[model samples]
Target: MKIFIIGITGRVGSLLARSLQDRGDTVSGLVRRPDQQSALQDAGIVAAVGDLTALTPEGLAELTGDVDALVFTAGAGGGTAEQTTAIDFGGVVTAIAAADLRGIRRFGLVSAFPEAWRERHLGAGFEHYMDMKKHADQALTHSDLDWIILRPAVLLDEAGTGRIALGPAELHGDVPRQDVADTMAELLHEPQITRQILELNHGGTPVAEAVQAAVRR
Candidate 1:
């Protein structure tokens, strides 16, 4: 399987690239800076550099040609509402349009847990971030493609516990970045996981088993 990953230099993206590559999949990553090339290269992933927010029709045509699946993990971290919308929401729209043009229907997204979007009623001051993520997730929901949205909780840098828990919007909790990456890689190979938005967290169990349980749900 050949995979095209956006934001491949990101924490989760880097891990996903390596995980896929190790499992014998050919991986290509979309990077924003030439300096990020080495990181992708180090992970044995081919790098294509461009700004997701600025992708033109022709640019998308050139980049997505021959790719099998696209995983969008790009984001504008800790930015103002406008900036967040530009990179997160607008970026997703751009990628979806580009993918459609190239007829690449398989897509995966790394989304935030819905709780992050809650306002004063649930939580406060994260409305902007939550709205940005919500908009992006909703856009993907209506896209003409096979897609799965994985919304994980507060991402931790701790070494992957290799455990994962998955449920509908009903489930909530934090998950390690590494496990999130692993789950994304696994979902890429499973067509049945399409058109679903799954919330993920640490299951205190093995990663593979947790994923299998999610699949069974």
Candidate 2:
């Protein structure tokens, strides 16, 4: 399978790209700067250098390079408020349009748990972040493409356990970034997983097993 990813340089994004590549899938990503191209090229991945904020749906679609699917993991990353909304929310909108324009039918989104605002409020900035994620997820959910929205709990950089609870279970505990990447890699490659919004957390079930279980659900 050939796949294109947004934010392929990020922690979870890089892991997902590696997992897909290890499985012999072609992976490509959009890099905003020319200097970032070398890293992806070093890894044997295709790099389409462009800023998400500036790309029209038509232009972005052209960069997809006739790939099979798109996974979006880009975030504001503590940028200014406007940048937060533009990247987090606006990027998804552009991606959706790009997918539609290109006739790409599958998409996966990396989002936060719904209880984010309720759990704690850092400030208006956080509230805005949650709002963007919420709307982005919603936008994809309502789009024509087959979509899987993975809402993971607190993200941990710790090594993956290869286990997770992936479903509508009550959200609890932190999940290693690797586990999330593994789960998403499977979901993107497997057609049987179906379309749904799954909540993820560290758990006893193996990552692949959890995904298979989601199909059974």
Candidate 3:
């Protein structure tokens, strides 16, 4: 499959890209600088140089053309408030539009758990981040596409256990970043698991089994 990732430079995004490439899929990513493009090319990814925050839907569609699937793993950390909205909320809007235009229906979004930030006193940045994530998830749900929203709990940088708790569960606990990417990779192969919102955490269930369990439920 030809897979295009929006945030291929991020933690989960980098892992997801590698996983997809390891499995023999054609992977492409939106890269901002020449250095990133060179690095991704060295790692066997087709790097499309462009900024989603600056691109219109038409422009984004052009970059994502001929791809079999699209996965969004971008976050708003370290950017300004406007960039946060652009990368989080606006990015989804453009991707949905671009996908619709290009006749690409499969989309996978990496989002934060709803309750992960709601029941806390996180600062304005976090609050805004959650708001945009919620809106992005909503946009995907309303679109005419085969979309899967994975809301992983607080992401950890620890090594993966190859297992995760995945389903429509209450938001709690922290999941390793590799596990989330591994689960998303598993999800790309399970197209039958469409239009669902799933929560992810570190657990005893293998990634494939966890994804299959969600499909069964």
Candidate 4:
């Protein structure tokens, strides 16, 4: 399968891109800077360079042209609330609209747990982050595409255990970035896993087995 990943240079995004490539899939990464192109190429990913936060629908259509699916992991990364909203919420929304226009139905969104939505954690840095996350997830939830939203708990850079708890149940804990990437790679190949929001953490069944079980739910 041919897949495009937004924010493919980041920790989770880069892992997902490389993991897909390892599985013999054609992986393309959307890079915002010219200097970033070589890194993706080095990892054997086709580099589609453009700023999703500012790209028009036409430009986005061209960038994502002929791709089979899109995985969005873009974020403002501790920037101001406006910038966070622009990239986290606005960027994903634009990509989703562009994907629909291009007739791409498969989308994967990397979002955080909706802790802020449940309890108002106003004024905290985390509150702003979750607010943006809530909107982005909602946009995907209502889109025409076949979407899977993965809400992982505190992201750790530790090595993957190749296992996880994958479901809609209220799972809370830290999850390694690599484990999240593992689940994403499996989700892409499993057509049975569409239109669901699942939480990921470091425990329980093996990643693929957990995914299969989650889809059967």
Question: lDDT, candidate 2, residue 178?
Answer: 92
Q: Put down candidate 1 lDDT per residue, 90-131, tens digits, no spaces.
A: 888888888888888899999999774343363332677788
Give the per-residue lDDT of model 3 (tens digit) for 1-217.
9999999998999999988887888899888898999999998888888988888888989998798899999877757779889989998999899988888889999999877856678789888888899999999999999999999998899999998899888548889999999999999999789999999988899998888989955
Per-candidate count of clashing residue pairs (backbone under 3 Å): 0, 0, 0, 0
**Candidate 1 global TM-score:** 0.91
Worst 10 residues of 3 by lDDT: 114-123
Model 4: residues >4 Å from true position, as ranges?
A: 116-122
Clashing pairs in 4: none
**Model 4 over residues 66-99: C-alpha lDDT tens digits?**
8889999888888898899999999999989889
**Of the candidates numbered 1 and 4, which has the greater TM-score value?**
4
| Per-model root-mean-square deviation over C-alphas | 2.4, 1.2, 1.3, 2.0
Error of 1 at 89 (Å): 0.4
User: Which residue pairs in model 1 clash with each other?
Assistant: none
Candidate number that wins on lDDT, 1 or 2 = 2
Output the worst ten-in-a-row residue range by lDDT, candidate 1.
116-125
Q: After best superposition, candidate 1 residue 39: deviation in angstroms?
A: 3.7
Q: lDDT of each structure?
A: 0.81, 0.89, 0.89, 0.86
lDDT of 4: 0.86
